[model samples]
Target: MLDSLKVTVLAEDSVPYESPLLGQHGVSFWLEATAANERRRILVDVGQNPDALLYNIGKLNIPLAQTDAVVLTHCHYDHTQGLAQILRAIGKRDVPVIAHPSLFRPNFITAPFFRHVGVMQGDEPADVHAAGGCLFPVVGPMQLMPGLTTTGEVPRVSDFEEVGIALSTIDANGRVVPDTMPDDIAIEARVKGCGTVIVTGCSHAGIVNILKHSVRPGERVAGIIGGLHLVEASEERIAKTVAAMSEFSPSLVAAGHCTGFRAQAAIYAAFGDRFATMGSGTVFSFTA
Candidate 1:
């Protein structure tokens, strides 16, 4: 287990009250995980706007050059648009970039005109490699440190939740099929003496399911952070999600980005002060 975890919101859809940092329609977090004397700086997702992200990084005094790794939670544009440029900014060769193998596959919506929603041009796997970043398409949970691990592919066990939007993709047989977003994943940090803290991105697999997949047999939930993707969900689903989330009793709920206001209000009502609005420049600290 790690000694402590510091999560700094590098970019988000909003800024804190009167904050000078720029906000965008995405999420990015700088994770500083400490295990004894060893510390690892991991970047989770890169918001669409590289300028805003870099500006906020400078304002927040984050050193991207020394970053240890980058983790992509999914293939959404908002989460991955600026990855290549960000990698170049790091000026490092072979920086590990972790994600699912289907990350570069075709993913999009049918209505509102045909448009691709997955990884766009420039930040493709080849682009990442050209930018001196090495891509690791993992099929199973991988450990970043002694206690920090990726959830791999989250199991869709929650019957009440679904992906906030309808997406489709083409299979190897050239048949159009429903995109279940098997790439949706999260980071779980098992802190010593404490419990598990989950950091997610656009939880298309459902937050409750991610939580259930994250927590061990007898472990408690220390905190929950990142977007829950309830922007397009029904009120019934939102209520059910909030009710189900309360069952886990997470110590903190800092949801933002495409989480939407309805779900945020319900989460606030359920979590009270434990529910915080994570925005650009916001920082959360946890100890063992």
Candidate 2:
């Protein structure tokens, strides 16, 4: 059986009216799907502010008990900070927490001006004490459920994809150093009769590469959802990314987060109505 999927943004730059929810500078996606005769719910990336995450989830009236698992794409604070709150909300249930082993490494990348913003240091894994959940380390592509899988460590395929982004982690000497994004991964869902939907939380590992790695050898592309992380791209980089994306023939793109408004404009110009904006309070459903 095919799954019924709905992606709701529990936190984003904008909030829905009547919800009185405030927007935070982070990204989190709440996804639910029914597959293999069972209803499955997964929270991909827990967002930064717990209050905002909880408020939006409550405002959306999502049943916390229904959540089956929590997948942290990476150890970035914006993506994993509110995990504790989510586990608390779920109560008593011990779900699996899938992530890269590096996710628990301390002193990951520091934001451009992290000192001024007073964000927590990325040294420890987010606390999940609701029922003492387990951390499932993943490397390379791994099956999450029946039709859902994680395209682990996307390859850098284009110059524009890594333009000017110098990611780093603290070394053994505790000095900030340069590093590549080995922990980056994207979630892929094989939709029945609709092909696949490759969802990412900031395509640090190239959006083009994520789509290419999601398939076996020659599978058709369906949709590309989530952040493309093209905020500070140069015109040349943007042009190249747009040009390459066209070849994949994705049906729809629900992109946001670090994608930036300017980048989205360029994408809209190239892809037209196929471009989608993802944020808090947004919902995407897939039915079989």
Candidate 3:
């Protein structure tokens, strides 16, 4: 039986990812979480370009048929754009697509003053059929696979995270609605002795919230991998984040994607070598 899980970073902006796998822009990550003698692969987000998504998958030597499930952090094209090409690979593989149900909404990417640039142009697929088909539409917290579960919409409880950033969508009725990014979710894996590894995307709800909500009040957090959304964060916010992270005492901090280089540097400065870099191709083995 499976006694451990392995994680692989398929695509991202930093680390050793191949530029030719996908266009230089956009974010996509492929994670292979294995346990027992079987392996299950997950596409955290598909890149903006279909070709890059396919190429990256091939370059990584990850078989398309082996993808067990596809989880989206949100509906943004950068996160879900690759669904089209993926659907063509396995020919309607009945894999479960996990994410907040709101991801399927129409005009989900419409934001004011930046509609053209928010979601990648020409990246939207006409339908899920064109995109890959997902069997289970997870709206809240639930066990997705063995030792793997999704942390449904994270609660926003930190004041330091409010740096006056606008993340919302404009409705057809001319309503400018605040974007809660309800579709945001994180994958939590329990590692034997090592504790829990939280794999987050964008962390739109706030990384602290994602981490806090993913585990019980007293459970130890072992490691964190993925976007911290600290690219434009103020120093105060960063300080608060660092302070909160210090409590987790994670063995490693593999930060990337929307995590600004400056923020990554700051994290490294504070945590020293405990903070490591993660990108496409980076892998971590966990023992149970």
- Candidate RMSDs in order: 0.9, 2.9, 3.2
Off by over 4 Å in 3: 15-23, 36-38, 106-112, 116-126, 130-132, 162-165, 171-174
Worst 10 residues of 3 by lDDT: 116-125
Q: Candidate 3 clashing pairs?
A: 1-36, 2-35, 2-36, 83-132, 84-131
Per-residue C-alpha lDDT of model 3 across residues 172-255, encoded as one tens digit per residue: 697867666767788888766677888877787788877778767666667788888898888888888989988877777888
Which candidate number would show the highest lDDT if scored against the true structure? 1
lDDT of 2 by residue, 1-288 (tens): 246667788887655564466678778888776687777788888778877888778878878777778787766677877576667677745677787766665433357643311124431444563344567878876776788877877777655567236566667898777656677787888777676777788787778777667765655566787778888877877788888888877778877887888779988998999888766887777665
**Against the unseen true structure, what C-alpha lDDT does each candidate score?**
0.93, 0.72, 0.70
For candidate 3, the per-residue lDDT at 206 reads: 84
Which ten residues in a row are the worst by lDDT in model 1? 214-223
lDDT of 3: 0.70
TM-score of 2: 0.88
Which candidate number has the best TM-score?
Answer: 1
Model 2 poorest ten-residue lDDT run? 114-123
* Candidate rank order under TM-score: 1, 2, 3
List model 1 lDDT by residue over 241-267, tens digit each: 999888888889999998999999999
